[model samples]
Target: MNLTQSEIDLDLGAVTMSCTTDEVATVFAGLLREMRSAAPFIRPDERDALRQIMSHESGALTAGEVFPDFARGSDAHTTLRKLRTAQFIRPAGRDCWDTGEHIEIRPFARIVWDRLGEAGVFGDPPELEEDDIDLALPGADEPVEVALPAPAKARGTRSGAKWDEGDVLDFLNDEDTQG
Candidate 1:
């Protein structure tokens, strides 16, 4: 008889078992634990933005990295702040891997991807017997509705404690802003 995931009884009468993995998986598992606890509290777009970031090769990425020509302003600020507060993602330093030092990005994508997968959002994937069974928070069983907000029009960047888009010196090297 084929039993469904939720229906399977985990009684395991007299047998004992444990799950094991290397350092990376261990770290991932830790974050997954926190996320599972907080999943019920996570916002929709916040999850989407994080999931998009996680779907990338590197777990960390700026909102600009996720959305081209957008995500560099207030929306980015709000989304980043929300995820950070939820403890879903943490500062992984600047976007030094590619653009180098424009914005700070977070790393927690892979965990979120694995999270969405287990929700069956990706639909009926095969699972090995050794996988950890997650009794996720009830509301998490549904897919998060992602309503991506529009990017802010007036772009003003903050560097250090002060807000400055570009120095007059940096502008001198460019055309439109140049004399």
Candidate 2:
């Protein structure tokens, strides 16, 4: 298949198999890098907050540790809400969020992370614990939209039965078989 310039730039691997162009792939890698770079030393409250976000979508998180005033501040609450709306996270259950849920990291977020990873933006993997996620907020009423990479151009030959060298060979071969 003839690849367009955009496709070429994106570095789509082979024609077969599910693959994303390099451009969008890089984006997802970047997000992962960012997550890794953030020191795992997030405040105990922050860890709890993240866990809560993860739990809501996946339906249940192991309970053990206690989080302090992670959800006390208005800004923190607002930020959590926004993140949930963006589909970056969601409330898990009774005061806990699930971070590992597939939906938490939207396709767009994945693309961003991929891009960042290509750029080598992450320093080291973060040592996050289970309590990093918190899930206290009520579920969001609106649906979250995760943007996908632009569709690839359709692949095919040019219009009209133009006679190329290969076409001529095949035509002759067919004629010989008929004779």
Tens-digit lDDT string for candidate 2 (116-148) = 441232343464688785453665655555322
lDDT at 30 for candidate 2? 64
Model 1 lDDT, residue 104, Cα: 34
Q: TM-score of each candidate?
A: 0.35, 0.28
Which runs in model 1 stand beyond 4 Å of their true positions?
1-30, 67-73, 94-112, 115-179
Clashes of each: 1, 54
Q: What is the lDDT of residue 107 in candidate 2?
A: 46
In candidate 2 the C-alpha lDDT for residue 170 amounts to 61
lDDT of 2 at 149: 18
Displacement of the residue 20 alpha carbon in candidate 1, Å: 9.4
- Identify the runs in model 2 with alpha carbons over 4 angstroms from their true place: 1-20, 39-41, 58-87, 90-179
